[model samples]
Target: QQQVRQSPQSLTVWEGGTTVLTCSYEDSTFNYFPWYQQFPGEGPALLISILSVSDKKEDGRFTTFFNKREKKLSLHIIDSQPGDSATYFCAASAGSNNRIFFGDGTQLVVKP
Candidate 1:
């Protein structure tokens, strides 16, 4: 069975502090990993992604560290601002199928 799992159901941090979210998958066939960020009223938007071929991926203030051998990955938020307070989901999918398995997000709160 294919599955994605995320840790820390919720997180609280002060503005400018960093937070880390973790995820793991059960399927070795999965190749694409994408992390999505979502605000209160809006839909989740793609934040960063990493391919199984690479071990790490970074975009601006967000970074995704992947361990293909262990089927685990982590998303790090650096210099987190209040605007960064949102739910983050770790999703995975195989290239053959359009289906993506999304883990329950970790809700983040950045206090000013």
Candidate 2:
């Protein structure tokens, strides 16, 4: 039941536009939420995160909004730029095992 699902396999946005990626989980035990951003042919790095106890997290142009009651979460990118084009992954962990479950991923492209 440790499955996390993400929507919009790919997204294309113009520079300065806003991009949104959606994710949902099947396991209620998931308590730690993190979003990873990956560039071409590179590993993902942590962007923003929120615990089940919190509802929102923000870092610069990246923001993660979480909903514990709905078991859903989303990442918002503001002032999109070509440099922001990359694959975004939503991940979750139960906080007990420390093992993380990741979504298939959403490929985002910000066109200049």
Residue 28 in model 1: lDDT: 89
lDDT of 1 by residue, 1-112 (tens): 5399999899999988989999999888999999999999999999999999999988888899999888999998899899998999999999898888999999999999
Model 2 lDDT per residue over 55-95, tens place: 98889998899998899999999999999999999999998
- Scored by lDDT, model 1 comes in at 0.93
- The whole-model C-alpha lDDT of candidate 2 against the native structure comes to 0.93
TM-score, candidate number 1:
0.95
Q: What is the lDDT of residue 62 in candidate 1?
A: 89
Which stretches in model 2 have alpha-carbon errors above 4 Å?
Answer: none
Q: Could you tell me the lDDT of residue 15 within candidate 2?
A: 99
